[model samples]
Target: MTPITEVEGRRLPLSNLDKVLYPATGTTKGELLHYYAITAGVLLPHLHLRPVSFLRYPDGPDGQLFFTKNPPPGTPDWVMTAPVPRSDDPSARQVVIQDLPSLMWAANLVVEFHTPQWRSDAPAVADRLVFDLDPGSPATVVECCRVALRLRERLAEDGLVAYVKTSGAKGLHLLVPLVPTPSEEVSAYARRLAVEAEAELPSLVVHRMAKKLRPGKVFVDHSQNAAAKTTATPYTLRARRTPAVSTPVTWEEVEACTDPGQLVFLLEDVAPRVGMYGDLLAPLFDTRGAGSLP
Candidate 1:
């Protein structure tokens, strides 16, 4: 095992290097070593023994994270993201995770929280429902963005404040945070939104449960919005060679991205650390008047 080094502000102890392995993917090559090295450095302080995980983004380096052996059951995926230059004109070097074991070790030390303010102990005040929309055709990423904005407006009108974040892949996720309610009600709310989507973009969107039924169109995935269900938290680090994270984006840039695969942010590019559950998703922590993290 190698000693951990400090970068930015975190100190990483690289004492473990026997448990991690990298899967081969064209997204990045032979760079898993570097990724693990960095992941261990970034996530070591937050690890735990439970099967914890979150999506990673590719911003500064290739996308990947040193975490979970495999994601927990019911985890949402393809939420991975990577940051890319408007142009790779200089053909910069791809970042890498050099030590797998340490990265994997560090991964275990961190506790991952998705489904914001999700708790089995404390009373949940919000039910997080997300509509992660992906295009069915090659028409354009903007076309999908147009639909996302329309969807966000529609959700907002219903009293559920909608926040938009990049899947860090190609799609945009419309998040609706509500007072913590049961799954059945959450599912129903999702169903209503799905219906609304179909009504608003009859030609572009479909709510059919059967994937085969909705050909060449965007489908509203109400399934993820179910009670106790979760969507990848925006800016989560995923365990892939090229670390990808979910990103919050301005609606204008949403339409400009071409490939759904290209719009993610890397761990290096994400804001450092989180304050409890993080403020972007602060409503989940509101507990209304419940007072501090319980």
Candidate 2:
């Protein structure tokens, strides 16, 4: 049964409040909505006006998952959506999340994570460049961090700042803010940078997406920077057994950190951490000072 709840003055009908999304941690759907509500201050800015595609897990993370780009039929008109071109049909519009109310509405729909595009329409520019450092079976988040630190140094040499975050799984993400570069240009730069990083650190990084080659190296995935590709929005709880989050961390922590588990922020840890870090990647969304690549 579903129950209608009030969120930010909007009515949200949430089903299975006690339904366990993360069985190991017993985290419920209600808890997920609450987390989004509490972290909206830091999260909404990243989601505002950006196209979003959802990975819905109707039966929780342990069950089957499906991806949806359009607002399901019967969606309320109050929910904001954008009409982005579909890959198969350029004219066909795909719905996107644009505000907090829409965000909460998605949570109720069993959207496990809020993943948004890298660009926003008003600014009409690539807001950030992302590096998805995925570690293979033998390689872990700890190893991913080592690779992240190295990439950070390289980005510094390139005259850009990189922010670190856990991938909510066994990996790390390195995001760099850009000043309105074309999505294609940003994607090209990311790809070249990843390839360069792989070439420079062949022993530590893998540039390809093949699963077999990733066994003992960090996969420096640069493809997420493309125009329509999405990355997990910060502060969203991951669909993991323990309900881990894609959390932002400091470079200091990245260098000294050995156990990746310690850095796995939870839904409960966000508010206080944001209090301390004040949205470490928030500047990535600001395009007012958008400058050309240095």
lDDT accuracy of residue 19 in candidate 1:
30
Candidates in order: C-alpha RMSD to true structure: 12.6, 2.1
Q: lDDT tens digits, residues 1-294, model 2? A: 578777668887877888778887788888888888888888777776776677787677788888777767778888766666666866654455667778788878777454544544632257677899998878888888888988888888878888888877778888887776777888787888889988988888999999988888999999887776788877667766777778888888888888867778888888899988899877676656333565
**Which sections of candidate 1 miss by over 4 Å?**
2-117, 122-126, 239-242, 255-262, 272-294
Model 1 weakest 10-residue run by lDDT: 76-85
Across residues 1-294, which tens digit of lDDT does each residue of candidate 1 receive?
Answer: 566755444455543334333233333322433443443433332221112233332222233433332334432232121221123333321111223342443333332224422332222233456677766655344556777777777765665566667665556677665565655666676788788889878888877767665666776667765433455555544443445556565555565655655456565555533332233443433435221110
Residue 94 C-alpha lDDT in model 2: 45
Local distance difference test, each candidate: 0.48, 0.77
Q: What's model 2's overall lDDT?
A: 0.77
